[model samples]
Target chain A: MRDRIIEIIGTHGKNQGALIPVLKAVQRMNPRQYIPQEASQLVARIMGLRESEVYEVVSFYGEFSETPRAEHVIKICDSTVCRVNHHRELVDILEHTLGIRVGEASRDGKFFLEYSPCFGACDVAPALRIDDKVYGNLDRDKLEAILEAYRR
Target chain B: MKKNVALITENFHHYIPPDLAGYKHFGGFTALKKALALSEEDLIERIEDSGLRGRGGAAYPTGKKMRQSKAYQDDIKYLICNADEGEPGTFKDRDLLEQDPFGVLEGMVITAYAVGATHGILYLREEYAHLLELLQGAMAAMRREGLLGQGILGTALDFDMTIFSGAGAYICGEGTSLIESMEGRPGRPRNKPPYTKAQGLYLKPTLVSNVETFSAITAIVKHPQGVFTGYGTQKSPGTKLISLCGNVNNPGTYEVPFGLTLEEIITELGHGVAGDKGIKFVQVGGISGPLLPRACLKMPLTYEDFDAEGLSIGSGAVLVVDEDTDILDFLDAVAAFFKHESCGKCTPCREGNRQLMNILKRMREGTALPSDPENIQRIAHTMKYASFCGLGKTAPTALLSAIKYCPEEIFMRRGQ
Candidate 1:
């Protein structure tokens, strides 16, 4: 993870304008990992700065998570396209079953739910993400049935 | 779309012809010829007489802006075409730029002529990098055809336009902030009174019109009586270009006459909600317009209609929500956006929007105490009234409107 962060940051680090995208690439070094404490430290070290300095950039952005997500990550798309389709039923079922709400990992630590805006898929209304996978045209029963397998 | 027909989209309003041939077909730029024959004052009066309002959220009349812009005594005045449409759900301007670049260019050129501008600047959003190339192409074509630069269309209007891209700051959509950004300042907004029309870009009097507002000028200029007579009520005349996204059958931009009801527009043009979906809420006008509950969906999409509903039409950005979405989560995400976008220039927005996210995040996590909902309302209400700039002032409008109509939906379990 440390070497990968250096490589990504080192490759495009000279361009100040590339900061946002570079930081994003560094953040995604561990795809399944959420916000790790050392991630900021590593970012600071890679960028030749203090840990608190890198932490500022991480905390500033809404997309960067501070911790690792659950085994199954579910982001319901509330973007312009998805809103037209309606994902409330699926969100509700996930909330009820996982015993967690949006932007959170379940108490059992198996699933995470978050809201995302505009995934550029207005054609298929009501979109969702499981781990990194996107699903569309969801119904509540199917959402629960899909989640049952992720639980184990 | 009409027994009274309308064409407002790339799908519908496509292949618009240009030049004398195209102009005659669509009745183009006749207003310019007439206005040129008359005086600038007469041109301004023609527009004010038509009762055309600004499409960029302020609802200020366009003719008034032109008159005020004309009042400035700068040797070099400017017409800044605000294509940096940073609003989240709004794409009406994008469509206008894509489908009818000439019409949009003509509006800016004529507007510059009226305002006595020699140079024009289009502050386009960086995301639409392709549009930068498109607009430049159009300008090059205009210049080659002698429609741009000195003595345009054989008139004294010597106007040339250049395009500039914004570096990912949403607050730059505010006219003042846009000027500041162009002057190479950080995109944080400034207080008004030294309004943009009076002392804008580089301390010269400037006129900033939304891309959609500029496009509407062509239609108005084409037919003087058509401007006043054809569409909308007397107060708010002319058609609106709506950016319709989400679960509609035809999810695209539609240019329709004003005063159409939400139900009428959604049902006829939006093709109604898919499946058995009943709309839970509609966030009218991008991020700032009120979050209209399902009940108000029947209201007309006019200025008066939203005014009656205690909402504003904002900039024709309609985000449709169906029965099953989580309102709390939606608020959380919105609050988070405002918080993230806060330029840190003022406390009401900087601190206020940040706190909004906290309360929302808490509510989402079930850590919010009993009085949390009330506190949430209090902060939002304060932000609405007290904030310094448009960013802080309208920051909480979506949340506030959401809470007003869907009082329980803001809190989980409470709404249930």
Candidate 2:
């Protein structure tokens, strides 16, 4: 892990502007999908910056998480377009299917459901993003089928 | 009479993914070739004559902005394409990149030549992560064809581009805030005076424009003079790509000339409200844009017309709301968005959003005092005048417009 982090930093260089991309690459490589305390400290030392600065960057953006996240993060659209299209019902179905409320990972560590601002998928209202793929115009069956595929 | 005008979107359906040959077959890089032959001053003047404005809400003259950057004497000036299309109810940029990536790239190269910029960066949002491979392939193809990197098409110009992904911050759509985020800090807006053209990315003379704006430049340079300006009204020339969403029956991206009324856009283009529902009101532009009642639909979709009614054609997102949805419920969603997306840098925005959300919540619960509406107005005005950035200043746009346009529907719910 240490060597990999160093290699990532080397590829992007030790510039301050390269911090976000480096951290993103590090977090994506982690098994738990988060930047652990040790990784942040190591990044700080190598980049010649304070540990707090690294942690602040991690905590500030919605994408980065310090603690462990589920293997797949389910981000439901909660903006005006989706809400007008009744995204609340989508949230209800998501919470019931996953058997965990929003902001919580499933007991088996498979899924974590949360809300995201509109991601320019408004054409298909009531959309959700799992990993990099976006699914929209959802109903109960479609939602269940999507989660089933991810669960497998 | 024509519902769709295909200028930037002319070859949208023809090209396959990353098909450089197909893009050329449809007359793609010919504009760059023509632009390369002209002096920088002539190119800028032609763009100015076309009357093309910034497509990303502000509507500043694109040619004027390019001329301003050209005045500065910098060895390493940067041209940053703001692809951070985080605006709610907007997906036109995503469509353009997906269908016509080469047009956008061609525009970037032409703009770089005009401004004498060596480095170009496409600030893509994280949500559009799926398009990364396609863009990379397109750039690689451009390089192979001598369209990008070190002496483009046997010219002395040398320019290159790279993609930088934003980590989900709507405020980063602001020019300075986007630059700040690129600098690896928290995505917060900086004080303006040395605007982005003077001192931008890495404190250099950088020119930041939206993805659609770059594509428009490509279109303007492609055709003969007065041909591109033939569409739309006298003040606002050329076509606009509108992301029509919400309760519209046919919700999608449409490229329309600027003279059509909102009613025509909603009815003829969008196929009217979904499920045959009656119209309640429309939110022109994105979430930050003002909400207009049905009566205002008669106004044409021009910058001058919208400006006359104290509204701007921001982002070209026309979000139609049906009569089935309540106005206050809609405002709640709008309030929640600002509260969540605020960078919390300044007091007026950070605290003002919290207060606005609280008051909206109380009003929804029917627990408001008579002073609540007045208080909401006061807080909104304060945030408008005092907030540090565009996010805070325009945060209360929807709420204030609700009060102004739909006062009876909103205050009646309070039984006042």
Candidate 3:
């Protein structure tokens, strides 16, 4: 797994500009979908960036998770547009169904729910992104069915 | 009456993005070909005469920017499309990238030609990672059609672009910070003396404009200045793409001419506020923009009018609020957003946003200080005058404007 991760990082090249892209590539390689401390150290050593610098890149961006993440990450839009369009209700539904509040992973490691400010998809208000795919104009049943697919 | 200029949003509402064939069919690269025929000076003059301004909220005249870059003598010049659409409510750029990728590329092509830039970079936000493949495909198609590679369209000029996805940072949308991030550092806004136009992107002359600005450039280059300037008002001579959201019935990207009144925008294009509720206020631009109460609805949505009213048409993101909404809650969200997104390089912005967020949190819990509002204004004033960049300077706008216009909601509010 480490070899494969390093191989993926190599594909991004060893330039300072490759730091963000390399980190993203490493995280995607991890099944837990996060840049583990060891991975960060490896990236730091290989890319000639300090460990502290690598960690700074990791923590500065909201997308980079320090700890292990669940199989699927669900990001609920928390901007004013989503808020006015009952985004709170969507949060409540996800929390109730997944048994975890915002920013927490479900106990079984099925989902991680977090509030993202805006996905730039306010055209269809009340949106959420489960992994890479964005599902907009969400209702309770639609949300339930979408989660069910990921669960299975 | 609402007038629409469909240049930026030509391929919207379509199932698939406009591929090279589709883009060519709709007169896509006509601008680049036409621009190639004209001398570089004339090309820049056309843009200057067209009265196109930066659509990335600053509204600086595009012609002046191109001419400035052209004046600089450098072996290597750069043109960057600021597609890092991280503004809280602004999604018009996203629409441009998703729908008409080639139009934006063509704009950058013309810009590079006029500025004598050989390299271009599209600084896209990482959250829109899905669009990377789509853009790469478009670029590949352009290469195959001889539109993007060396000596594009059989000319001596050489220019091409590659996408640089920004790691998640709202401050990166700022041009200096974006250039810093591109150079492989934490995204922090640099102090201005050597402004980006003069010394930018590895200490060379660079031209950075928003995605929508580039799309408008494509249109201006394709047609005559009279044709491009025919739609909008005299001063603000071009249509603006507004990302209308929040308490609006028709919430989507709408392109309207500059003279449209805010009331007409909310009613005619927006289809009025959602649920037929009375409007409490509307926020023009994004989170960092001025908030106007219902009384100012008749104000024309122009840079001049908004500027007179102590507002800006920054990013053209109009977020409407209804009567039932609590202004305090909105302020809390705005404060929190600035707090989270502040680059923390300068003390005034970093500490000021943290302090503002803390006070708003206290207000949410009914434990705020009596002097909290005054403190917020003071911090806001200090940050406005002292902070390093636009992020800190404009961070306090929503709260300060709320205090000025809708004090009844913010001041009298109690427990959650």
Best by TM-score: 2
Per-residue alpha-carbon lDDT of candidate 2 for residues B1-416, written as tens digits (9 for 90 to 100): 57788998998989895999999999989999999999999999988999999999999999999999999878899999899998899999999999999999999999999999989999999899889999999999999999999999999999999999888899999999999889988899988879889999998999999999999999999988887789999998889999999999899999999899999999998999999998999998999988899999999999998888888889999999999998888999899999999999999999999999999888888887789989998999999999999899999999999889988877777544
Where does candidate 2 clash, by residue pair?
none
Q: What are the per-residue Cα lDDT tens digits for candidate 3 across B139-227?
A: 88888888877889999988888899887889999999999888777899887868887788988888899999999999888876587
lDDT of each prediction vs. the true structure? 0.71, 0.91, 0.86
Q: How much is the lDDT of residue A84 in candidate 2?
A: 87
Chain A TM-scores of each predicted structure, in the order given, are 0.71, 0.94, 0.95
Q: Is candidate 1 or candidate 2 better by DockQ?
A: 2
- The candidate scoring highest on lDDT is 2
Error of 1 at B104 (Å): 0.7
DockQ of each: 0.11, 0.85, 0.72
Model 2, runs deviating above 4 Å: B414-416
Q: Each model: TM-score of chain B?
A: 0.93, 0.99, 0.97
Would you give me the overall lDDT of model 3?
Answer: 0.86
Output the lDDT of residue B76, model 1: 78
List model 2 lDDT by residue over A23-90, tens digit each: 98998898657899999999999998888888888888878888887888889989999988889999
